[model samples]
Target: MHQTRLRITRILCMIMITALMVPLFSGCASKGNSDADKGQTAQPDTQQQEEKVEEKDPVTLKFPIWSTITEDLFTKLDLVNEYKKDHPNVTIELELLKDTEYENTLKIRNAANELPDIMPLKSAWLVNFKDNILPLDDLEAAKNNLFAADFKVNDQILGVPESQFNEFIWYHKSVFQEYGIEIPKTWEEFVNAAKKIKDGGKYIPIAMGGKDAWPDYPFNEFMPSLVAGDGDYWSAMATKDEPFAKGQPFYDAYVKIKELYDAKVMGPDPLGVGFDQSKLMFGSKQAAMIALGQWFGSDLKSMTDVDINDIGAFLLPVRDSADEPFNTVSMVDTFYTIPKTSKHPDEAKEFLNWFFSNAWYPKYMSEAGLQSTIKDVKIDLGTMFNGAFDVSNLKYVLNKGGNEDYKKIESTIKFDVKKMGQDMMAGKDFDKMMQDMNNSWKNARSKLK
Candidate 1:
């Protein structure tokens, strides 16, 4: 027992001595402590750096568009708010303007170098603002766009098209069947059918939003292209001195349009109604038909009173004969162009990249009910497109507003075809109007540099 107690005491003293001597060994304890100190201190410094890297400066992008905020494509996509999800520091401010004044507003603002940071221009209007806009040749959005290359000015892509589609005369099929009328295939047939609908007099034969002036695009803006079977007819016309004279496509189209107007079929007061009112007329079944593009399909859906199943579409037949090649407008519209004056161009570009990225573009395309302009990205258009291509010898007319010279002459002469359409609805002498337009165009062309 005495020997065991002494052994236990000796072991205890040795253990205590070893523990006390640990710090004295600088080689082992100091090396271990140094490593431990580094592990403990390095984490916080690394964390602080990570926190710094995660921080981003907030940015706001100004985007102005013609369509009302409710009808705008950006709104449909929830673009402004949606972009803020991943890019919490970014905001897209949308400025809405009337479609009639949209281009003119941009032009007026452009004179002062005050175009919106991001502008959505028509394909025809792109060239007009080429000097004020930035070349987007380097952007992946432009690179992947199928229609972007087609609309390049001076071989430099200035804008990227988001959608490509055909226009149609959206009509009530039930009303057509009720009147014992078939879908018209020629200009004469279409006019005669309108007359027949008028004779019945139960509904307005065709609803027109001539008050807005822009709503007459189907007749005023596009008929000349249809008559010439050329999409770039405006550019082709610039080289000629009297392009709007009789026998010319522009004059001929205007004549046909005037004849339709004379028939008293575009409703009692077509010029008194705006686009929204006209849409309501058609949706409420008070009007048999209304001319619009596929884009109207979404707006049509918004009308809670209308039965979507009853609406059908067909290409407006501008040919005098069904045997002639039927010309259809295949427009690639809404070219997203960034103005040179954008303060946050980098952020704008980043938003565009994110917008056209695979994650967003396809879904947005589907939501808009539009065909994708992105290469290899096919969109399935809605059922309203069925039977729209049942005509023979169809030709596509792609509108490129005009060449450089045409736009210059147009601005100088204040040649507003859409406004002229409104004037036609108000009973202008068609021949005299053409003669005056021809004279103005010739005078403007002579002064071009």
Candidate 2:
């Protein structure tokens, strides 16, 4: 009987052990499966992110410029090869166009919705092209550009200027000394000095390239801005029905310009000579002076025949009195812009940022002999500009673009101040032209959309 009872106890112990072992094995199996499932589910997500990061599409950017290779500093910098070194998948193709046809060509392309990925804009065209351009306000390039914000349209920066320059009356120092004339400080003095040089009959007093019309910018396009002491002169003029009437600022400026043209101090047949001829004449010492912008300094440097050491520059005096504020044209030019129609907007922005980077901007500024428009960059004007800017009442008249309404009025009237300059040189009746402009301006103002 004792042996049989011991066997039953052993059996009961075996049963309890089996039951505990079953549950423990089942728990281990469940935990293993759970971990395997979690890893299997998360692996694809990690791979997907890695794949997304590796995907890049090849891109090509169409960049058109009006400046030829000789005039464009980027060409000398090997811009394409340098850019290609880091971006093998990207290409920049620049097309050269005639400078005279550049604006009209762009207008045509814009109408066809085929504008290039990148282009340069003048301050005056910013308003006309604002709608088609993508505002660069968010770009680092725009943020770094000192003049970009100053030319914003509707609070959006459409483009950023690469350089800043002042208009100058480039002269031959020897000629001035020979004629016993000093750098003019007022409008009267300027005309008188030119008259004196003409009276000597040794050389042309001033080089007037009236044929191209654009070469007349210093007097016709800019004098009114200098008179107003800002770039808002044209926009302000658009507001009135007769902005060119007698006693008006536009009238006052044009009258002064007319007086200069009438002096016949720019040579016997100023209208017949084109800009290239005028520039050559000035370079060869046949002309004493030429009214051009600071960019001309670089052009002057390119002339191998001329003795550039004799060249001097000064701000064009448009003020009536030496006591008045000495207003001068401070132009921010070569406004690089990206079109809204660009195929590769992000890539174009990247290129622009890189263009303005420390790698390229400083070198370009030095090579082009242009003042830096970027923050944290400086350019020395060198000896040619020594004492040229010495004035107690000097004020910079920044060339901010006109407002939309102004552009509309301008387009309607077909008003071209530079062309007006050509007409003045051609001996057109000045008052009659101003009156016609007033009539056209009034008629245009009444038709705005």
Candidate 3:
């Protein structure tokens, strides 16, 4: 009986030991499960952190422009909107202002070192603001342009031209046909054609917008270069003691313009009208011709119902014979620039890459009716200009370089060449005008030296 009791006691001890061991094992298993859950949670946390690092940060760029929103600005706005579709993280803010106000405001902002991210700069103004502009020489878009290589400031390309324009005398094809006038090949022929148009008494030979003053640039600012067959005529004249002498290029060109004025072929009262009025006269077929650049095509297209086929263009024909090399004034009209003070420069540059890409560049130039600055991209400016001059073969005289010394001289003298044109139209003595201009030029040159 005592042996049986001891055996029962040992069995009881075994059961107790087993029950205690079960709880300890259960505790270990619970701790293991907790650690595994934590590992799984940490893995997701680490993945989320990596994803956050890979994501792009949202960026906004500020762009200020000085053109009518409906005009050139709309095309740019459309491009920005299109860019946004591909880059949802990027936004562009456009600041619109009148041209004059924009220039003044930009100048003020530049002084404060707070310029916008992207802006349009005239080639002449680039020299003034190049210190604040970022160099674009490394950009792929800039590298592809035909004219960008020529536009350098201190060996750094600060801007890129989007479009180019050539100066021409735009005439009505129907007008010439109606008057039995062949397209003039020389200045003399052009003058005789003008006289014939005047004698016909049906139309103004040339529409002269004298009241606006700037309308005279074709004759006053550009003709001397055309006559001299030199793109750097004005710059060369800066070194001359008597640039307005009787036999000088400036004097010779002015004499031809004076002859037109004396012949009364421009209009009944050329000095009384402005650019808009002159355009109206030409559009209504009351005038046979107007001298302007390619930009006038858009304006004329909007103002008149005349068919595009009725319009024609020709070089100004300053040379004495048809065989002589004729020079046309060409200009790099608009430049795209990035300011050094930009908050989103990299984003702005990214936008430019998309802007000048093959997908957008051709469309932009075509829609804007501007000559493409991109190599291998040919835009038809219409049959008139296409037939009139072979763009590849024509001698191009670029617009005069901006001279700060001349600017200072102009500001000091307050001599208005446009007003001189108006005076010429009003029968002022050409010789006296020449003498006065020489004296003023001499005075200005002395100050420059």
Candidate 4:
């Protein structure tokens, strides 16, 4: 008994000694991380002593944004309350604006050299203001390593991409199934399907808001990809100095539009309606389907509460035979830039560096039905994103690189052709209308240097 007691007591003492020494050894190890420590280079993820050595009071930064994003996401205003377990000194000012007013208002501000410290500018607008914005490349931690090679021109890092957004043709699966309709695999099929839906005493097949030039994007810029047969042809059109209205591709596309309109496929009074009206048409089950971004997933579900299994999507089908239908548009989803006039450039950049890298940012975006530009993160596809389609913005653009010429068409031939389309829908002759569009483009292109 005495011998056993001695052995147990010895073991207990050793354990106690080990327990106390562990923390001491850990502290020493952290202090000894230099090369001399050899093999002790790695340390535990505990707070670094350097972080504690010189902590400054948190700096408040104002971030102006246009979206109707909730204040719950303003971490700076929350001051990392959940994370730091206390209020942060940084406060973000949230600025919301209607879509129409956002860009124009920013442009006005830009003219006066007044832009927000952090402003979410549309991608195309970024091209005009690239010089006024600060580049994120200089920050060591902020420099995105994954897509390092992608950073080009003027050292601009732009803003981190938020979500997978694709322009797609979506159909109501249940409605299609009830009508025994197959999803359209070609543009002709799409038009024919619309006619069938209309003949069945259903509302016209597609809804649109033509007043907003943006909604016209699909028909103007994207639909041409179908007629041009591939992206390369579209690119050629961009550099040709001849307007799109001069080409066979442009002619073929307008012909398709005429076919749909002649078939009475578009909702009656499409030009008279607004975006919400069209959205309501699809949401309230008045229209069969529409082409729009995947971000509409949340709104559609909210408006209808339809089962996830019932929502269906497919890329816009090609009109002519081709290797593959160009499935996406390569536009920048959205961007944020530091303006030259910002009062706190360095601070704003610091905040963005932390903001983009924050783990919560990705979750917040996913919850809000957005995709991130940052490459490392993956979506969990929670209740919201599950079965909600998304595609990589990068791949989407590259695939459409062959179709970039389509964009030039909108800037060049769009107004004239759309005017002609309006006349055609009013029962005008196709050839005369085509000739008018070609003449308009010829006149306009000659004005350019």
Full-model lDDT for every candidate: 0.87, 0.88, 0.79, 0.59
lDDT of each residue in 209-280, candidate 1, tens digit only: 888888899899999999998888998999999998889999899999999988989899999999889999
What are the models' TM-scores?
0.88, 0.86, 0.81, 0.70
Q: Candidate 1 or 2, higher TM-score?
A: 1
List candidate 1 stretches off by more than 4 Å: 1-42, 69-77, 111-113
Which of candidates 3 and 4 reaches a greater TM-score? Answer: 3
Q: Count the backbone clashes (under 3 Å) in each candidate.
A: 0, 0, 0, 15
Distance from true position, residue 177, model 3, in Å? 0.6
Model 2 compared with the native: what TM-score? 0.86
Pick by lDDT: which candidate is best? 2
Question: Pick by TM-score: which candidate is best?
Answer: 1
Question: Given candidate 3, what's the lDDT at residue 139?
Answer: 91
